[model samples]
Structures are given as C-alpha cells and as structure tokens.
Target chain A: MAVYTEVTDEALAEFLTHYNIGSMVAFRGIAEGVENSNYALKTTQGDFILTLYEKRVDPADLPWFLGLMEHLAAHGLSCPLPVRARDGKNLNPLAGKIAAITTFLPGVWPRRVLVEHCEPLGAALARLHLTGEGFAPKRANALGPDAWNDLLQKSAPQADSVQAGLGRELDSMLHGIVANWPRGLPSGHIHADLFPDNVFFLDGEISGLIDFYFACTDIYAYDIAICLNAWCFEKDFSFNVTKSRALLRGYMAHRALSEAETAALPVLAQGAAMRFLLTRLYDWLNTPPGAMVTPKDPLDYYRRLRFHNAAKGAAAYGL
Target chain B: MAVYTEVTDEALAEFLTHYNIGSMVAFRGIAEGVENSNYALKTTQGDFILTLYEKRVDPADLPWFLGLMEHLAAHGLSCPLPVRARDGKNLNPLAGKIAAITTFLPGVWPRRVLVEHCEPLGAALARLHLTGEGFAPKRANALGPDAWNDLLQKSAPQADSVQAGLGRELDSMLHGIVANWPRGLPSGHIHADLFPDNVFFLDGEISGLIDFYFACTDIYAYDIAICLNAWCFEKDFSFNVTKSRALLRGYMAHRALSEAETAALPVLAQGAAMRFLLTRLYDWLNTPPGAMVTPKDPLDYYRRLRFHNAAKGAAAYGL
Candidate 1:
C-alpha cells in the first residue's frame, strides 16, 4: 500500500514521448508494492504498469530485473515483460528516478491461501527457474545467508524491544544455521521472495508470477525451501503438511529434486527463515516515523524458523 | 492516496455474485480519492471503479450520490455512471460497508491547470447542472454556510496555533459573511467540490467529471465560486484572471448566469472559501495520531478567502 512518488500529468506525457506506446488515456497510482511507485496506465495502445523505482531499489540493479522479466516472458513464463522504449532500452529516466513500463498482467493475487493455489505456484516457480536459464545479466541474492550477519548486527540492538529476549534467541539461531549452512546442490536464478502476494491466480490456476525485484541467482532448492516456509504456514503458525506435499509434488512434476537437494531442505529452510526474520527485524526496528507501510512482524518468521528446526529432513516437508 | 478498506479475495468473489459484469479479471486498489476505498476493477465485461464507502462518507447519502451520477450520465454528461447489479440496484453492500461499481472513465486529471482546461470544466459543470435538473433524490450541501458555525466551533480553539491572530480574523470574516450571505441565486444540484483533480482531460478536451460524492443542491453560481478558488489559483496563491474569464465565458455559453447570480458572486465565493477553510482547519486539528493522510493546509483556503474579501464584485473575477 505505497505510492511514495507522484508523477504529474505533464511529466507522464513527456515521459511517454520516449516510448512507442500510444498516447496516454488514463493513469492512476496503484496502491500496491512498497519498494517503488506503480501506476496502472491505460493508453491508446493498451494497459500497462508504469513503475518508478524508489530509493530502496538500486538503479544499477534495474537492468538485471528488467532483463530477467524480458527473458522469462520470452521463454513462456506468464509474467510482465518490460516495455522497450524508442531507444530500445527497457529502463529509462523519469521524475529523477529510474522508471519503466511493463505489460499489465491480468489476475488477482490470492488473499486466502488454499491447497489449490499451492500446486500452481510450485509449478510456476519451476517454470520461472527453467525460463530464467539464459538471462544474460545476473544479480546475487542480496538477502542470502552471507548477508544475514549484517542484518542481525543492525537488528540486534532493538530486537528484544519487540519481545523479551527475542534478540538473544535470534542470535543463537543465526549462529547455529551459519555454522551448518548446506552447500547447495542446485543453483540458478530464483524468485527469492515468492510470497503469495506476488503470485496471481485466476479461475483456480496460477495466471502470472510478479514482483521480480528480489529475483536473483541463488540455490534453486533453497528457493523451494523459502516456499516451504512461506506457503506452508497457516494463520495460527501451524504447519499445513497437505499444502507442503502439494507444493513439493507440483515442483517435482516439473523438475525432480536430486537427493542432495532433498537432504539439504531442513537447513536451507532454516536459512530462508533466518533471511526473512533478520530483514523483517531490521525493518521493524528502523521503519521511519509516520511511514504508510506496516512493518511485518519478525516474530512470524521466528515461529516458522522454530518449525523448520523441529523438522527432521525433507520428508517432513513432504518432498 | 487512500484505500482504507481491505477487500479480501473471498469477499470480493462473493460480492461479485450479485453483479452480472462477468467474472473478475483483475482488481487493484486505486490510490486516489481521500474519502472512499476505490479499486480499479477489470472484469470479463469491462473496466470499472469499485468503491467501498468509508466512514467519512455518510452511508445515507450513497443513494443520492449514485443517483446523481446515473442521472447526469444518462442526460449526456461525461461522468462515471453507477453500474446497476443484477437486481438493478446501483448501491450495494460488500465487506460490511456500502459499495458499488461504476464504469471507468478514461482520462488524466490536469496536474497543471491551464486556461484551456477551465473552459471545458465550466461548460461541463453547467451541463451537469442542466442535466441534473430532474434528479429524484435531493441532497443538501452538507458543507454549506449553515454548517460553518459548527465547524468553526470545533476548529476555533486551535485556529491561532496555525497562524498569529488567524482565529480572530476568521471569526470576523465568518460573522460578516453569515450576516450578508446571498439568498435565492438560482439554486440547483451542483458539483460542490469540482477541484481540478476531479476533472479529467484527454487531448486538450474534458473527457469526464467525477468524484460526485459532494454533489448536492446548492446555488449553481456557488459551484462556480468553488471552481474559481480551485482552478483559478496558481501555485504561488495568485489568481489567474485569464482562466477565470475563460471559465465564466464557457459556462455562459452553455447556461447564462442571472444578474442576481452574478451580483452574489463575491459573497458566495467568500462563503465557499470559509466553508473549506473551516473544514480543513478542523481536519488539521482532529486528524488522529499516525493517520496515513496528510492534512491539507487550512491556510490555503484562508489565502483564497482574503482574495475574495478584497474583490469588489463579480467583475473582479472576470465574470
């Protein structure tokens, strides 16, 4: 629920001159996504999404994000392709920030997670990984395990302020996970943040995958591990085994997991949980006064991490 | 930049059962308008705006607002027409709040108001008045002069806090205007808040007039007064006589103003300014802690009120 920047009508009209898209007909800021300002634009050509990258997004990484979307869309993944400007570049300058327009995908992200959503999401994840094989540009998973130490250091000072001794507990967990972190068996570009909100569904099927800001080259099985934590958790913090099995089986239907990938699931899942937990904790502690966004509770991931800790192996995740 | 209510996928799906607009293709909360939760909705039928009435808007006034849009659109005014459901009701309930879908109008609101925009706006406003002559449900101008006393009472306590002696100045102005408030100046349904943001433009022509939540029976010239304060003011708070003349001429081309209406212009404009000033002042003082909205500067209206006070007559506005 963020549109941090306002693009004036004159600015938008001038910006559109760089594109081959028809004259702008309508545009309204979209109240979704926190990292950038998004507007649903309608032109004589068609409907598209105009994204103005905010400060949180590095301008340098935009080409990678835009290129990845272009490659994936071309390879038959249902996702938005960045619209190339008249100069043959998808990334362009507008309103003092890097901005780009992408073809608008039509579908609503599922609000109520169901078993039906899990399978399609798993299949789409595999497809995206497969389709992303030949993308020329690459970005490292910035929130991966290697970066967890810095996040922990930043969040450590105020962690217990959220809950008593929460800082100590997280510190202990981080050390254990870092010490035993697995060498990934499979690695490629993965949608590091494939939360339900980023997956669109229509008529009980996954229609598109979106929000590739966090997409990066990472352990592919670790990507599955992230989903296991993200999609397989319930509102009361209970594990939904049926949904886990559905997601894993759905992924296996497309790309079978090697034995090493399967064996590494628990440790990978713990690392994934730690990744989100630390980031959320940092945001929870550092959200500026009067921010429109509600910082997600880091404790949610703490609970998920506990579940992953208790689970023995990939069998526990129905892999 | 407001979407106060969160409409879940399940609730939206259930709500659509009442409509015959085909299956929902996409829905994104629109980051526009301050008083309601608006979603840019697309379905198998076409694009539309789905609004969930927030607490700021009176639930009782929903019928009049919806009916006014229906009447004006049917009478050939380019505005959003309320879409009737399968049961033929323009107003319905969803997510425990009053909600309805209206056909989406395509155009961008003029961010930089120009003289060209003023003419079409004036003409369209006059047509809205003419076409609204027979609207069945009547809504009184809730923010008219009669309501100013209560608003002043609520805001007067903190008035001087915003500016030195501002409270005393507004108090003096309110008394004079209330004593000499114009009477019987050819009243009818008027778009009371026809701000530039509500008027959409495409290709240098007015495409539609929208945000009819404030439509009510008021002196038609008072609507012009509101526009004069809204559209004829530059960023530096100076009046633009050229735009004002264009607006008056455009309105007269459609529906001529009576001599009495013209004579009442200065006082009506002053009253219009006071109405906004008081309401804005109240909002400024009463906006809850941590509320997402940024309260508008009450002094903007106070500055306009000073302009209206200095004007000798309608001629000062190029009428």
Candidate 2:
C-alpha cells in the first residue's frame, strides 16, 4: 500500500508520449509491494505495471534488476519483462522519480500454503535458478551471513523486549551459524524472499514470479532453504513434512542437489530463519506504534529457527 | 488507500464462479477512494472494478446506489454499469462482506482544475441530475446542512486549537446560512460530493461520474454550489470566476436555473463550504495522528468558508 509519489494527469500524459505503448487508458496505484510505489497501468497496447523506485531502492541497482529480468525472460522464464521505451531503455524518469514499466503478469499469489502447491513451486524455483545462468551482473546477497552479526549487534540490547533472553540466545546462535556457514554449494541467482505471497499460481500451476528487488546472487540451496521455511510451516509453527518432501522432490527432479548441498539444508535453513528473525525483530522494536503497516511478529520466525536448530540432519527436513 | 477487507485467492476464485465474467486474468488492489475496498479486476471479458462495501457504508443503501448507477448508465450517461450475476441481482456476498462488480469506466479525473474542465463538468452534472429523474428510490443527504450543526457541536471544543476563534466564528456563520437556506429550488437527486476527483475527463470532455455513496435527494442548486467551491476555486482560496462562469453557463445550457436558484448561490455556497469544513474539522479532531489516511486539513476548507462568507451575490461567482 505504498504510493509515496503522486503522478499528476498532466505529467502522466506527457510521460506516456515518450513510450511506444499506446496512450494511457487507465492507471492506478496498486497496493502490492512495500519497497516501491507500483501502479497497474493500462494502455491501448496492453496492461502493464508502472513502478516508481522509492528511497528504499538504490538507483544504482536499477540496471542490474531490470537486466536480470530480461535475462530470465529471454531464457523462457515466467517473469515480468521490463517494458523498453522508445529511447531503448527500460528505466525512465517521471515525476522526479526513477520509474519503469513492466509487462503485467497474470496470476494471484497463494494466500494459504497447501501441500499440493509445494511440488510446482519447487520446480519453478529450480527452473528460475537454471535459467539465471550466464547473467554476468552479480549482486552479492546483502542480507547474507556477514550482515547477520551486525544486525544482531544493533538489535541485541532490545531483543529481549520481543522475548526474554532472545538477545543472548540469538548471539550464541549467530556465532554458531556464521562459523559453520558453507563455503560453496552450487551458487546462482536466487529469489531470497520466495514466500507464498511472492509466487503466483493459476489453475494449480506456477504462473509468475515477481518482486525482483530482493533477487540477488547467492547459494542456490539457500534459496531452497528459504522456501522450506516459508512454504512448509503451518500456522501453528509446526513443520509439515509431507509438504517438505514434495518441495524437495520437485526441486531434485529439475536439478539434482549434490550430497554436500543436501547435508547443508539444516544449517542453511537455520541461517535463513535467522535472517528473517533479525530483520523482523529490528522492525518490531523500531516501528512506531501507530504506523500504517503493522510489523510482523518476530516470534513466528524464532519458532522456525528453533526447529532447524534441533534437527539432526537433512533427513529431519524429509530430504 | 483503503483495503479494509482482504479477499483471499481461494475465496476470490470461488466468488468469481457465480459470475459469467470470464476467468480472472489480472487483479490488484487499487489505491483509490477512501471508503470501500476497490480492486482493479481484469478478466477475460474485460476490465472491471470489484468493490467490497466496508463498514462505513450502510448495507441497506447498497441497492439504491447500485440502482442509481444502473439508471444513469441505462440513460446513456457514461458511468459504471453494475454487472448482474446469473441470479439477476447486482449485490452479492464475498469474504463476509457485501461485494459487487461494475464495468470499469475509462478516464482520469482532473488533479488540477482548468477553465476548460468546468464547462464539460457543468454539462455532466446537469445530465446526471436530469437523467436521475425516474429513479424511484429517494435518499436524504447524510452530510447536509442538518448534519453541519451536529458536527460543529462535536468539534467546537477543539476548533480553536486549529485556529483562534474558528469555533465561535463558525457558530455565527452557521446560524446565518441555516436561516437563509434556500428551499425548493429545482429539487431532485444530486451527487452531493462532486469534487473534481469524482468527475473524470478525457480529451476535454467529461467521460464518467463515480463515487455515488454521497448521492442523495437534495436541491439541485445546492449541487451547483458544491461545484462552485470545488471546481471554481484556486489553490489560494480565490474564486476563479472564469471557470465558475463556464461551469454555470454550460450547466444552464441543458437545464436553466430559476431566479430564486441563481439568487441563492451566495448563501448556498457558504453553506456548502460550512458542510465540508465541519466534517473535515470533526475528522481532524477525532483521527489519531498516525492513521494511515491523513485527515485532510480542516484549515483548507476554513479558507473556502471565509471566501463564501464574504460573497455578495451570484454575480460574484460570474453567474
């Protein structure tokens, strides 16, 4: 529900003139992503998405994100294609903000995680990683292992406010996870935040993958681990092994995981849980009481982290 | 930017099954209109708007509003057409709330009012009033002059907090306007809230009129007075007589105003301004500081009230 910048009709009319897409038929700010201002723009040409990169996005990373989408789309992946303007560039300026238009993808993201949804989601994710090959621009995972300690240090003082002894417990867990972080395990482009809300499904099939702002270069299996935590957990914080087994089998069918990759799932899943927990904890402690967007409960991720910590090995994940 | 009720994907799919409007191709929550939850829904048939009536709207009035829109569209006025389901009824239930689908109208509302916009807007308002003749249902204006005094009494204690002496000044002005209120000047159904945002234009012509929640049975001249304050005023609170002239002239080209209606513009305009000021003042005082939608500044309407209070006659508005 972010529309930080308002584009006046007069300004919008002038802006569309520079594009080959037919004149604007309808345009509206969409309440979808949080980091950027998005509008569902319709023209005579077709429906498209217009995004104004807000302050949270770095203007420097614009090219890489747009280029990555192009790379994936060229390889026949179902993703949003950045609409190239008559100027031969996807990015353009409008209303004093860096804005771009993308072809509208057709599907609704699943709200409830179902067992049947796991296999198809797994295959699509693996295909995404395989298709992202040969894309030269590499964006190091910003929320990777190195950043966890810094996040922990900043949040340590007030972490107990979320849960008693959460600060010290996380400090020890962070040290262990960072020390045991794997050196290499088939790395490539990964959608770090592949939550159910980011993956769109239509008629029981994966139709589209969106919100590439968080896409970056990272361990491929780490992406799988993120999905394991996001997709396999039930509302009561219990891990569903049937969904986990299906998701893993779906991934292995597309691209087989190495013996080492399979073994690292437990630790990687723990680290993945840590990344979200730290961020959510920081937000929970910092967000103003009456803020527009309610901060998610950090304890939800903490419970997942506890499960990953107690798991003996990959078998615990039904791998 | 209101989406009070979130319609889940599973629920939405089952809900759309009742309608013959083809499968959903693309849908996104739209950040427009402050009242109901609106989604820009695109299906195989065509683009449409899905509105879930929130608690702010009375469920009993749903039929009248939908029927009025139907009547308007049936008369060849460019407005949203309520799409009927197989049951031949427009109203239906979805996600524990009443929901309906309406054919989407094409056109962008003017963000900045120009002189050229007033004439077409005037004609459209007249057409809307004239076309609404046979609609049998009658609804009283909820935010009429009668509501103004109650709102003022509720907001009086803190009115001076916004500006010195604003409470007492509004009290005396309210008495004068209420006592001098016009009666029976071409009374009919009126779109009580015809601000520029409610009127859409394309290629220098009015293409659509929307947000009929405030439409009610009232003096037609009072509707004109609302337009005078909304469309004919500059940002600095100075009246734009040029725009006002074109608006009234364009309106009368369809339906001529009687002598009494013309003479009543001064007090009527002041009353209209007071109506908005009181409501905005009440909202400003009641809404917490950090609410999602910022309450519109009551001072802006206060300035408009001051101008209307000093207006001598209809000639001052270029009538």
Candidate 3:
C-alpha cells in the first residue's frame, strides 16, 4: 500500500524512451511491495512491473538482485526477468529514483494459506535455491543471525508496551537462537523472506515467487525453515504438522537434505522465527501511528519461536 | 493506497464462476480511486477492473451508477461498461461485499495537466452531457448548493485552525452563494468528480472517463465549471486564461452553450468552487490524522472561489 514517489506522465514518457520494450500503453501504482514503488505496466510488447527503488532500498544491491532473477528465470524457474533498455541496461533512473522493468508474473497471492498451497511453495523455494546457485554476485544476508541482536535491542525499550515482559522474553530468546544457529549447512542464495504474500499461486500450483529484495547468500535449510514458519502456521499460531510434512516432503523431492541439515531443522526454524520476530517487533514499535501499512504482530512470531524452541528434531516437522 | 477488503483467492475463484469473462489469471489491488477498493484484473478473456463497493459508497445507489455507465458506453462514450454476469446481473456479492467487473480502460491520466489536455477534456465532458440526454434514472448531487450550509458549519469551528479568519470568510461566502445560486441551465447527467485523475488520455486523445461513483444529474454548465476550476488553474492557484479559453471553446465545439448558460458561467464556476471548497474544508477538519489520503488544502479552492466571485462573466474566462 505504498507509492511514495509520484511519477509524472511526462517523466514516464521520457523514461520509457530509453527502453525498447514497445510503447507504454497503461501504467498504475499497484498496492503491492512496501520497500519500493511498483507500477503494473502494460506496453505494446507485454505486461510488466515497473519498480522504483525507494530510499529504503540500497541502490548498490540492485544489480545482484536483477542478475539473480535473470539467472533463475533462464534456468527454467518462473520469476520476473528484468527488461533491458536499448543501451542494454536493466537498471536506470526514473523520476530521481532507480527503476527497473520486469516481466509481470500473472497470478494472485493467496490471502489465506491452504494445505494445498504448501507443497508447491516448498518446491519453488528449492528451485530458486538450485537455479540461483551459480549466480556470480553475492549479497550478504543483511537480516542474518548477526543482525538480530541489534534489531532486538532497538525494539527492546518499548517492546513490553506491546505486551508486558515481552521484551525480556525476546532478549533471552534471541541470544539462544543466535548461539544455536546451525553453521555450515547447505549455503547458497536463498529467498530469505519467502512469506506467503510473496508467492503467487495459480490453480493450486506456485506460479511465481516475487519481492526478491530479501534474497541473499544464506543456508538452504534456513530458507526451508523460513517457509516452515511462514506457511505451516494457522492464524492462531498453532503449528500445522500436516503442512510442515507436505512442505518438507516437497523439498526433499527436489534436493534431499543432508543428514546434518535434517537434524538441525528445529534450531534453523527457531532462528527463522527469531529473525521475523525481531524485524516485526521493530516495525510494530516504530512505524508511524497513521502509516497505511499495518505492521505484523511481533507476538505472532514469538509464539512460533516457542514451538520451534520445544521441537525434538526434524521429526517434529514430520520430515 | 486503499485496499479495505482482502479478497481471498478461494472467494474470488468462486465469485468468478458466475461471470462469463473467462478464468482469472492475474489480479492486483491498484492505487487508483479513493471511493472503492479497485483491483486490476487480467483474465483469459481480457483485462478488466474489479470494484468492491465499500461503506463509503451507498449500496442503494449502485444500480443507477452502473446503469449510467452502461448507457453512456453504449451511446459511444469512452467509459467503463459494467460486465453482466451469467445471470444477466452486473452486481453480485464477493467477499461479503457487493462487487462488479467493468471493462479495463487503457491510458494514463495526465499527472501534470497540460494545455493540450484541457480542450479534449472539455469536449469529452460535453459529449457526456450531450449523450446522457435521455438517461432515465436521476441521482441527486449530494454536495449541491442546498447541502453547503451543513458542511460549512461542520467545518467552521476548525476552519481557522487551517487559516486565520478562514471560518468567518467561508461562513460569509456560503450564504451569498446559496442565495444567488442559478435557477436553471441545461441539465443532465454529469460526471460530478471529473477531475484530471478521472480522465485517461492516449496519444493526446481522451481515451476514457472513469470513477462514475459521483455521477449525478446536475446542470451541464456546473460540470463545465468544475473543469474550469480543475483544469485551468495552475498548481499555485493562478488561473490560466489561455487554458480556460481552449476548454470553453472545446465545449462549444461539441454543444454550444446557451446565452444564459454563458452569462451564468462565472457564478456557475463560483458555485463549483464553493462545492469543492466546502467538501474539502469538511474533510480537512474531519479526516483523522494519519489517514492514507491527504485531504486537499481547502485554501486552494478558497483562492479559486475569490477569483470566480470577481470574474466579470464569461468574458473573464475568454469565452
């Protein structure tokens, strides 16, 4: 629900002149992506998305993201491929912000997660990891375990305002999760923020995975752990074991997990839960009172972390 | 930036089963109109817009609005024609709210209105007034002269908070406007909210007019007056007589104004300015802080109102 930068028609017409992707016929600011401004664009060539990287996005990292998507789509994964201009560049300036056009993936993200959606989502995550393996450029996972301490500390002062003693619980929980974060477990580029809202589904199949701003070099199992926390939980924060099993089975169908990766599932999932909890907690405490976006409840992830902290092994996830 | 209703994929799929517009392939909430939740929908058959009526829109008035669009489009006006479902009904329940599908109009609204945009805008508006000659159903202009007093009173207490002596000025102006409001000019269905944002242009031609939720039976000249205020004013509130001349001349090309309508133009424009100023004043005073849509500055219209009040008839507008 964010369109911070307003693109004037004249500015847009001039901007489109650099591209060879036909002429702009229709464009609209879409209520998608919070990190940047996104416009669903239709040209004589095809439908696409025009993303203006806002202040929130570091312009330096865009090449890595665009290149990764190009590589993934080239390797048979369904994702947005950045359209190149006549100068053979994918990234350029539009209305004082860096912007890129990517092929529009046609599908709607599920508002309500169904059991039928989990397995296909798992498969897509695995496909992304496998296809993105050889991408030359590397991006450090900015929200990795190393960053959680600072985030939690920033959110600590007013955390209990959300719920009394909640900050203390998070302070204790984050330390344990970070220390126990499994090291040396199948690392590669992973879509670190593979939430349900970022995956589009068509006819019970995963049509495309989007919002690759969070993609980074990270543990493959950690990505799976993110999926577990994101897709396998009911609204009440109850873990749906059936969904978890289906997700894992779907993942294993592509790339069978290492024995160590399998055994470390609970800790990895705990780390994943902690990662979301800290970020959501920060947003909940800091986003301006009247902002259009309703920040996710940090406490929702807190309950998921508690479940992950109690899990026995991969068996707990029905893996 | 408003998406009040979150339509689930399951619910949408079920909803589309009643329509003959092919299966849905893509849908995204677009940041377009402020009155209703709008989604840009691409189906196998063609692209369209899905509008879910929110509480801001009176459900009882939907039939008249939808019918007007259908009638106008059928009469060769470039507008969104409501798509009838298999049951021969255009409106139906979706996600617990009434929703309808309409033809997706291509073309972007001029973000910064140019002189070239005014004449076409004027001509299209007259075409709308001319073509809507025989529309059976009539809708009252809810913000017409009779309603200005209550709106002014509601906003009066807080008006000075926005500007010194503003409340007193507006209170004094409202009475003068109400008493001198014109009796009868050419009357028909008018696009009450035909601001630049509601009109789309393609290749310097008017492609379509949209957001007819505010469409109501009113004086045709009053609608033209709205355009004079909306299109001919510079961002700094200075009236561009060159643009106004082009606009009035364009209207004259389509349907020549009667001598009475021409002489009444200044007061009609004055009434139009007051209509917007009162509503904007009310919204400015009433909209809770942190709301998504910024209430437009009431003073912008106040400045326009002052100009219109002093205008020496149609000659002042270059007619």
**To one decimal place, how large is model 1's interface RMSD in Å?**
1.8
lDDT tens readout by residue for model 1, B168-254: 888889999989888878888999999988999988888999999988998999999999999999988899999999999989999
Order the candidate numbers by lDDT, best to worst. Answer: 3, 2, 1
TM-scores of all predicted structures? 0.94, 0.94, 0.96
Docking class of 2: medium
List, residue by residue over B1-319, the lDDT tens digit for candidate 3. 6777889999999999999999989999998777789999999998999999998899999999999999999999999999999999999999899999999998999989999998898899999998998788899998888888888888888888999999898888878877877887779999988998899999889999999998899899999999999999998889999999999888989998999999988888988999899888887778775576657778899999999999998998997
Q: Can you give the DockQ of every candidate in the order shown?
A: 0.57, 0.50, 0.65
| DockQ leaderboard ranking | 3, 1, 2
Per-prediction fnat values?
Answer: 0.58, 0.50, 0.74
Provide the TM-score of chain B versus the true chain B for each model in turn.
0.98, 0.98, 0.98
Model 2, span B1-319: residue lDDT tens: 7566788788888888889999987778887887899988878899999999998799999999999999999999998999998889899999899999999988888878889899998999899999999898899988888888888999999999999999999999999999999887788899989998788777677879998988999999999999998998898888889999999998999999999999999998988889988888988889774455657888887788888878888889886
Off by over 4 Å in 3: A290-292, B289-292
lDDT of 3 by residue, A160-271 (tens): 8999999898888888877777888889999998888899988788889998998999899999999999999998889999999989888888888999999999989999
- Output the better candidate (1/3) by TM-score: 3
Task: Write model 1 residue lDDT over A1-319, tens digit each, in one string.
Answer: 7788877788999999999999999998888887889999999998999999998888888888888888889888989999999989888888788899999998998777888888888888888888888886678888888888888988888888998998889888888998988784778899998988788888888888889998899889889988988899999999998999999888988988889888888999999999988888898888764576767888999999999999898888876
Instruction: Single out the weakest 10-residue window by summed lDDT for candidate 2 chain B.
Output: B287-296
- Model 2 ranges with Cα > 4 A deviation: A152-169, A284-294, B157-166, B288-291
Q: Best by DockQ, which number?
A: 3
Question: Candidate 2 vs. truth: CA RMSD?
Answer: 2.3
